[model samples]
Target: MNIFAKTGGNMTNRRDFLTGSAGLAGILFCGCGLPRAAHAAAAAPHRLPVTVAGKHVKTIDVHSHCLFHEANALMGDEAAKLTPPINGAQQAFMTVEDRARAMDAMAVDMEILSVNPFWYGKERDLAAKIVSINNDKLAALVASKPDRFGAFASLTLQDPALAVTELETAMKKQGLGGAAIGDQVAGSEFSDPKFDPVWAKAEELGAVLFIHPEGVPELNKRWAGNGWLLNTIGNPLATTIALNHLIFQGTLDKFPNLKVLAAHGGGYLASYAPRDDHACFVAPSACDPNIKLKKQPTEYLNQLHFDALVFTPEALRHLVAQVGASQIMLGSDCPYPWELHPVDAIMATDSLSDAQKHAILGGNAAKLFGLKGVG
Candidate 1:
């Protein structure tokens, strides 16, 4: 018998049991007066974790993508025209049951879902509507399966003021974990002071800002080829530029406590950080005195978080070495087949200890997302 049925009842669907008269709060907090067998069954093992210090370490994936069909439809045909076919392809349309199967195969207990930014080029009113639809759908998904999913609310960052209000609503009323933003807002870099208010609000709420690449448009001509460099090379390069601006422009220094998670293992920044640290020292004249920071450019990396989607054990090891283990989290960039074996990648790394592996797998993300029952 299933959990609800074992409690002297006969509810087969977990979603129904969660949303029924019993309510989610009662079911989650053991307020439904379930017997020991029911409680044990309800807390069934969702994942097999690596033991450390006699404790099982649950895995949480901080980088995963989901698309809401209704939200995509609301954007109109023009939105569809702009979106790449890969986005609406079969893997992208996976149902919750399908996703659960994938997660089980990956040994992932929980996933933080965020939609890649698509409406950045849309008009203000239309963009706002898209944001609403996306957030509403995301909120519903999280509410329905609180244990399996968490979310980073979508925002129309093209308008910072509206974005701030939406962020507040998503966090306060919708109970989302944070917001996901693109590498840049249209042509404006994230370092522009116009976005400071949004950054400030994120810091105030302790909401993590996930930076996912939207691809660099300026390099279209150069990136055209059979190799798909537009994605493999251009994506990370765009993220690198976005993050460098934040460092050079003093955005990170201003919002020192802001929680930022860079997708694709912080792009190319972690691998090439030392170059930035030495740039100023090598050429004092090129480094403007006014923009001088309290610490080296690479030093700011420790203040942020990165996902382990670098695709190689060596690269993952280098990222961890550059930024401490606590600053990295497991991310598969799922539904795209990027980092096909994220768990195995970490496991194969000879440089990391068992404890550090536990942290990168889920402990760090749990603390960052404020998720409970982890570590």
Candidate 2:
């Protein structure tokens, strides 16, 4: 039966009966009163089905990638310079089918896709076009499989103005979740005044800025040709460098409302926070002497949310102990060969209470992305 069917004027009686059967089916079915699009999203099958504390739970993954081909092509000379010639066909790399399968395997309800920021440091026109194509593709990905995916628009930080325009178009028009920017734009740091306009706009709109590493040029030269040096090590090294720069340089201080999410479990920041704090204390003459501080660098980490991608249960436990579970989100850096199983990893962690487990599994991201029921 199309259970929501109505007759004449007794619609309320019909819905009351339908709810009983729908509940038995374990589906949160909506009536004709709900929007058609909403109903469709609610019915999508790409969701990961989890049994948490006896209740079936679902999740939202905040950090997943898609569409590397466009970025690879746009990278040009930089592409050749890469250690292993960037693979245009990277796994889970942005086809609708691949995404659906991955979501099902990982039990991820939806993945918020971001364009790799590796495409950002090149020619302005090409970067803009690449952004446009990626946005269009992302929007189409969501529209086609609204239940499986959502997007955080990629921006060309090379031109801050263009970034603002793309942000508007992606958020307002396409209903994207947020924007993703590299840790730095080319040689310029994220805290530079040139990016203030972009930051201001993101704050005004309450947009999320997912920060990822693109191997800073100067840092790249230092790690030269060593396998696992640039990516496995240098990437996190770059993340720490950029984060410290943003903090000590007063970027976070100035833009208190700006929401920036860091990848790879916030890199080395999570582990070496005390050093950052100590440096601030002893060498008041070092970085920014005039900048007054109240808390340690780790305190800011609590304010920011991190993905549960640290891999080991012990690491996950340490993260939970350090930042609390509510601030940790589920991120399956899926398609990356080294990525961990998010649900299993969280389950293996003995440090978390049932409530904390609920939050790490899906509750945190649900609240962050405004999903109901779970939150």
Query: Whose lDDT is greatest here?
Result: 1
Q: Write the per-residue lDDT of candidate 2 for residues 51-157, one digit (tens) a residue.
A: 77877666777877754343345567665443233333222123344446556666677788876666555789988867766666566556545566777888988
After superposition, the stretches of candidate 2 with alpha carbons farther than 4 Å from their true spots are 1-47, 68-94, 221-227
Off by over 4 Å in 1: 1-54, 79-88
Candidates in order, TM-scores: namely 0.85, 0.80
- The lDDT for every candidate, in the order shown, is 0.77, 0.66
Please write out the lDDT profile of model 1 over residues 193-230, one tens digit for every residue: 99999999999999999999988999999988787888
lDDT (C-alpha) at residue 290 in model 1 = 87
In candidate 2, the residue pairs with backbone N, CA or C atoms under 3 Å apart (3 or more residues apart, or in different chains) clash, namely: 48-107
